[model samples]
Target: MTTDTIITARGLTKTFTVRKAVVEAVTDLDLDVQRGELVAFLGPNGAGKSTSLRMLTTLLPPTSGTATVVGHDIARDPAGVRRRIGYIGQGTSAGHNQRVRDELLSQGAFYGMGRRAAATRADELLESLDLAPLATRKVLGLSGGQKRRLDIALGLIHSPELLFLDEPSTGLDPQSRANLWQHILDLRREHGTTIFVTTHFLEEADLFAERVLVMDHGRMIADDTAGNLKTTLAGDVITLGFASEADARAAAARAGGTAAGSSLSLTVDHGELVLPRLLRELDSVTSATLRQPTLDDVFLALTGRSLREDAATSKEEINA
Candidate 1:
């Protein structure tokens, strides 16, 4: 492994049996994550985002394949991997009965810190995550967002080099979610922490992560910078409105575009390069517009389904 590589996996696979039916949660996943990089893993439910994370964090052993996390083999040295990484799962990991500061100190103790060192670390995390005021409050008395912050502080007590966050903002209100993101970004900037996060919020992933990985049906479908994926896979959509339906059809045929009513639409790799030529070639063109693609459009183009819709439907199916 390279010195800069924080995570390396080869053909990582996991399977489960539910009601005598075989289910492949993750299949043949190969991944590499470098130091100090923030990456987002995005997919609908049952897309293996959590399964893959569990394997890398050593919470769930992979059925096949192998991986090394933070320079330690996941199978052979789970303790070493655990020591070097912090994991905040979907549910809050803080103890309900303990005081916020006590819980943080306990986490530090688990990592084998001296009492004074643990207390110092706990105070630092409490201040950093905006939990200093609530340090003396019982964990059970805190609000949802406060509890979530405590969970993050617990994870960071050891100051691991890498942090794995599984849906950290899932249950937060809009303002709280925004606050959490700011803290996460600040952690990366100040501590040079490598963040590997999985979130259902497409917009957050698009806006925050340096790189995005899209998984579907237990397989990784796309991996690239969000801007590159949108531009390369989905492209820019150019629409031209003609004077009449017949004119639109004629112009579409000449331009090799799709015709609808009085409009002709074509997706081009570079809309600016093609727009002027299209205007000159199509005499009946009245109005022309070019639209940039979003990460949602990229997902739709790759999987033939909207990720937002898939996520909602999957949730409903599970509840039913």
Candidate 2:
């Protein structure tokens, strides 16, 4: 690994025996994340996203292969890896009864921080995450968004170089999600922390992440910028509505597009340039609609299924 590489993995695999049947949770995953990059890991449920993270974070050992996190070999020196990285899991990590500031202080103590240092760090996080007003509030009394912010504070108690977040904003409302992300962006901007996160919200990844890694069926399939993936894999979609089904079919034949009912749809690299030409060439088009591709479109093109459908399904299937 290079000096600037925060994480490096090759042939990382994980397996489990479920009712006497072997299930591959993750397979031959190879990845490299540089320092100060915000990477979003995307996958359908039961697609091994969580399992891969568990192995990399040293919560679970890889069945085979090797990885280094924060300059420490995960298999040979788990303690070293754990000491340098922060992990905020799907579930809340704070105790319900403990006060927020005390919870953070306790987390610092767990990381071997002295009492005075832990207190100082806790105060800093409380202010940075906007949790200072609620520092003495009981954990259970805070709202869902407040709890998530506290979770982030606990993860950063040791000021680790890298942070791994698993569905950090899954259950928050739209406004709360936006608030949480703003704090995350500020953290990265202020501290230059490398963030590797898995999120169900595709828009969050598209808007904030520097790179996106897509996984399916226990294997890494695609990795690139969200813009590049949408442009190359999904492209722009143009829908032309005709006066009749026959007119639609004729237009499809002339334009090399697909015809369904009274509509002709075409996928092109640049819809703005192609749509006007197609409209001038075809006289039967009664209406035209040009749509830009989203990250969901990229997922559908890659997997032959919509990610929204997969995301709506029960998350319990991928608990491993």
Which one is best on lDDT? 2
Tell me the lDDT of candidate 2: 0.92
For each candidate, how many residue pairs have backbone atoms clashing (under 3 Å)?
0, 0
* Candidate 2 lDDT tens digits, 1-320: 22399899999999998989999999999999999999999987778888989999999999999999999999999999999999999898899999999899889999999999999999999998889999999999999999999999999999988999998998899998999899889888888999999876789999999799998888988999998999999999999999999999999889987999999999998899999999999998999999999899999999998889988884654556
Residue 6 lDDT (model 1): 95
Backbone clash total for model 1 is 0
Cα-based lDDT for every prediction:
0.91, 0.92
Residues 1-320, model 1: lDDT tens digits: 12399999999999888779878888999999999999999999878999999999999999999999999999999999998999998887988899999998889999999999999999998888889999999989999999998889988999999999998998899999999999999999988999999987899999999899999888999999998998889999999998899999998778887999999899988788899999887878899999988888989999999998998888621110
